[model samples]
Target: MRKRLSVSKWAITVLSILSLAFFFTLGPASKASATINYGEEVAATAETLIGSPYKYGGTSPRGFDASGLTQYVYKDAATNMKIPRTSAAQYKIGKAVKQNELKFGDLVFYATGAKGKVSFVAIYNGNGTFVGATSKGVKKVKMSDKYWKERYIGAKRVIK
Candidate 1:
């Protein structure tokens, strides 16, 4: 009986080591990870605030303006990253990309303010659509629309 018990213990140890080795080779079957795609993450975060009220200088779920929305989204979505607080400042940090080259999470600017300046900003969600906060509230708008097209200044990609 002792011999049999000893054999069983040895078998159990071997099986445990083998299981660990297998896990090491093929990776864990149910491991939690944090492989974040920052752009998609930012877009997803913005999508959750679809109907949030547009508040002047607001930056939280309670309310959000154009720059406030961008600032909050990037701060929440990306790790260890801080963005500019205003539309013009945000545009200045990112690399200038042509409108056609704009991709998901790219900041689309418009000359909505006086003097045709980059005063408005939106997050481009690809296929010529973008999400932003307007005077009405947070809503998705098409870049090809007459008003947006007329005001369209350019786009900038802040994500690496």
Candidate 2:
């Protein structure tokens, strides 16, 4: 009886240790196997347009509006995806993504005017930073800023 009890405890201990090891190992392996993100390509292309001028309906290298910039970048990345021209329309089309889950190439939207509607859009560059066109032109700004935090409406994922 004593020998049986000792063996049972050892088995339980071994099983617990193995379970813990398996749990820890599984996470990294799954993450490593994650599919390639096209957003990374879009983001890299967007970063190159940081200094471009902001033109209301511009969609080219010469200048870009908020949604225009996003449209250009994704298209430039050769994803061949179609995107809307206005910020509000763009917001309505993509998969809803929470602010906390924003990733590279994700569309971040804002309510900028007295009417407080979704009127502006930006491409998230990760690490709390996003690039957009404002009166100030194409620039990178942080969501933590007082102005932006208050205006932030939502985010959307355009890729898959």
Q: Which runs of model 2 end up more than 4 angstroms from their true locations?
A: 1-35
User: lDDT (0-100) at residue 121 of candidate 1?
Assistant: 93
What's the C-alpha lDDT at position 98 in model 1?
93
Q: Tell me the TM-score of model 2.
A: 0.74
Question: Candidate 2, overall lDDT?
Answer: 0.84
lDDT of each: 0.85, 0.84
TM-score of every candidate relative to the true structure: 0.78, 0.74
Q: For residues 1-160, what per-residue lDDT tens digits would candidate 1 score against the true structure? A: 3554345878999999999989877886547576877777777777888899999998998989998988888888764469889999998988899987877888899988776799999888778988898888888889999999999888888899
Cα RMSD of predicted structure 1: 3.8
lDDT of each residue in 79-101, candidate 2, tens digit only: 66779888989989879998878
Where in model 1 is the C-alpha error above 4 Å?
Answer: 1-35
